[model samples]
Target: MRDFFEVRDVHVMRSGAHGPLPVLGGVDLRVGRGELVCVVGPSGCGKSTLLGVVAGLLRPARGRVLLAGRDVTGTPAHTAYMPQQDLLFAWHTVLDGVALGLRVQRVGRREARARARDVLAEFGLEAFADARPDELSGGMRQRAALARTVLQGRDVVLLDEPFGALDALTRLDAQRWLAATWRAHRWTGLLVTHDVGEAVTLGDRVLRLSGRPAVVAQEVAVDEPRPRTPGVPDERVVRTVLAGLGVVPDERAPDEREPDERAPGLPVRLP
Candidate 1:
């Protein structure tokens, strides 16, 4: 059966000052319907680039991006992308911000605001409806941004470190909220994050990318139940993903190391 989402041997390059710089090297990935897939890689390994390609914001040098078995390369209609930054417009109220997508879709301002209010209440941000982006806490801002994304009603949501900027406690809160929200509305998701525990806790499967011009180094399936408690990822899953990323040293004896076995390449270390 065809996957709900597919990235087939995708390759991307950008023109650098010196010349062409390769970012993604023959990348292939897929996410089944309603599956949340987390991607971890060293910084500058083109994680965001991959999401951009999937989001149809960037055209791949080679390969195809398909949603629901139809090619959607360079067409963003199939996906909703939320970047690392909240990117909320300060002038827009929380309600207006969340309603932006609907408004863009030609929803009447009154109707958009009404729908936005409904989602805001669902997101527990109704009280902050009139708040500016600067007035809300980091977590609240992200929630507002997410509410906006969710309002797009897209089946695929691409998240690039959505909670990376929050404080540890706030991050945890955001994770719990996100997990619960995702569970209730099971959109196929691809999250790009450096947090191993986050990946383990939130993703149905975690894919690790390594080396410059990265490729998938490993894929770890997380068997834990959803709406997972924040901060405490399944220990075994965490260890497996951490080990794959070289965040944790292997316990093998020195003599057992094969000459052909290469060390894991990590772009960034996770806490």
Candidate 2:
């Protein structure tokens, strides 16, 4: 209904053993209430850096992050962050791990556990509530991670390659689950993904980032319907990104030549 997350001319510069480097350069972006936006880019692009800035893990040298008309730059707990790894403790049971967020937020013990159980059930992880993180499959662990985030009940979610570690089939399955979950909950989500298919499948709008000093190269709407079909979504958007990256020739014009099968480290790994 309103602008839930906004990044205006955001910039992140880092200085370590290496010289000063700009990871994000005047990046301008917005995620409206209940909107799902996906970010895709090359390997060295700063998609994750942008997420870190939004999550308040990294401070921007310039610009700001706004949540619900309030500035959250360098502030914690304004939004929930889900990193590439699930980060579930191996020793903790599924419910326990999920409840950790609520507990940290000082939600009452009884109330937090109840809400955690309910959220897990909603995600179809109720059966494994008592199981340890190691006992669950990859998808289930990610589900638990999401459950934890939802329990915090934050308005904006910064998802950093949440499904990167799963197998192809598992990743697809998780994508569907994530799409369904997003539809059901309708939280404003910003996801950073290297996989173009993942971006197309889950995003209402997709943004592509160029190399270092990452800037938005292109933003494409995913016109496909939600609850995406396996290959269909990939086919629709992957070709577009491939063309943008010059891996595939533009089909808009008549060209007898096919896409270069040998674009180094392209998303689909063409045969």
Candidate 3:
């Protein structure tokens, strides 16, 4: 596949009380047009930091971030980001907050809200449109924030654990919604998640990062059909990601993992 986004040898450092701490060490990855790539790594392994770099929230100490062949390193203009938290304003109504992205884009308020309402209706948040963030449930808040992120009209959307805050059941619902929306819109996404299942369910390919001072350790193609059955799609793929994170499944787990079989679609590179 042709590359739509590229992070080449990107490195980052964060200032700590003692000194500068190296976070990402020569990280590199690429995504094709309209593809969703999910990143998984241990907690505090710079997974989010990597997304921040691509989102233009942090300028890499070295290397560059390119989108559609243009260097957008350290620039937030071309991308839309939805962080871990919903980040909806307490004062702004759902309609207002969802329209924020368009507003910043210079779309007229009336027109922005009209567009926002259309998306809210589509996302099943129309009933809560005029309600404040605090009034909505966790899932609703996430949907609202997602609406804002996507309304920006950027081809790429950076998601940092977008469903992390919700409870298990709610998270599953959000995952389904996100998958369907992605299929419909065909937008490019780079999502970071601690949940391997989430990564497996949502990504066309799952990328695993090494420990701190992170880099791409491995990439597994999720060859399963779309809208996968979230948590139980494929144990072997889950095993592969877990292995990268140094995790081993229970010896007596119901399905005894085969010793030599690789995941069904051995290697997948979008074309």
Candidate 4:
């Protein structure tokens, strides 16, 4: 199949207190249908900024963003963006909140609500459909947000640290759920996360960006299968990188160090 998303020679800049700053520098990326690509980099690198550019929320000063071969630069509606926060409204029930996106697009009230309910059910949130956000746990709220994004019916989804705040168990659960959900729906997804484990667990290919004026530094492929198991060799790669970046420790057998942990996403600060 042809690539569902393509970005070429992309460059992005922002004007800050110091003046014009280069965010993304000549970055090239492509994602086939159902591909999940993770971007890892140092803090303050343009990881989130690159996501915004791909989502068409921010136009690159130079380059092109093509969705299924058509340029979508400066077009925001072609993609669904899920930020760090679920952004769930405490006053609205899960059904009502998830339906907001569809309603905004003028899908009739009954139709939108139905679509929302169905999507929420797929994520195992059917029982909580009438529950308010405050009643849901952090992970459930995030799941509700995912359902809302899916209901928006966008071909691409940009996830910005959607599982960052969850505890380890919840994070693992969410990751498994995401892989299953992505497989079933086959939406092209680009996820921005600070967690190396999350990136390796969900991404088909992981892209690393250098800090601001962020250029694609390196690309790592996570060739493992879905339902990633702990203590697996692939999972070790995640810990290796974490240790190398000083986030964790280089506690593995000494010979295991150099090649395995070399990818990227080292914590900005060493332990």
Off by over 4 Å in 3: 249-271
- lDDT tens digits, residue span 33-98, model 1: 988999997888999999999999999999999888888889998888999999899899999999
Candidate 1 has an lDDT of 0.86
- Estimate TM-scores for all models: 0.91, 0.89, 0.90, 0.86
**Cα lDDT tens digits for candidate 4, 98-194:** 9999988989989988889889889999999999999999889999998898779898899999988999888888887888888898788999988
Which residue pairs collide in model 3, if any?
Answer: 1-270
Candidate number with the higher lDDT (2 or 4) = 2
| Candidate 3, number of clashes | 1
lDDT of 3 by residue, 1-271 (tens): 7999999889899999999999988888899999999999888989888888888889999999998899999988888999999988899999999999999999999999999999999889999988999999899899889889988899799999999889999999899889878988999999999899889889999987777787777788889887687666577678777765668743433364333223432222222
RMSD of each: 4.1, 5.7, 4.5, 5.0
**Model 4 worst lDDT run, 10 consecutive residues:** 262-271
State which candidate has the highest lDDT. 1
Task: Report, for every candidate in turn, its global Cα lDDT versus the true structure.
Answer: 0.86, 0.81, 0.85, 0.81
Sorted on TM-score, best first, the list reads: 1, 3, 2, 4
Candidate 2 residues lying further than 4 Å off, grouped into runs, are 16-18, 253-271
Please tell me which predicted candidate would have the highest TM-score against the true structure: 1
- Candidate 2 per-residue lDDT over residues 122-202, each given as its tens digit: 889999999999899999899899889867888788899999999988888888778888888998899998888778878
Q: Among all windows of ten consecutive residues in candidate 3, which has the lowest summed lDDT?
A: 261-270
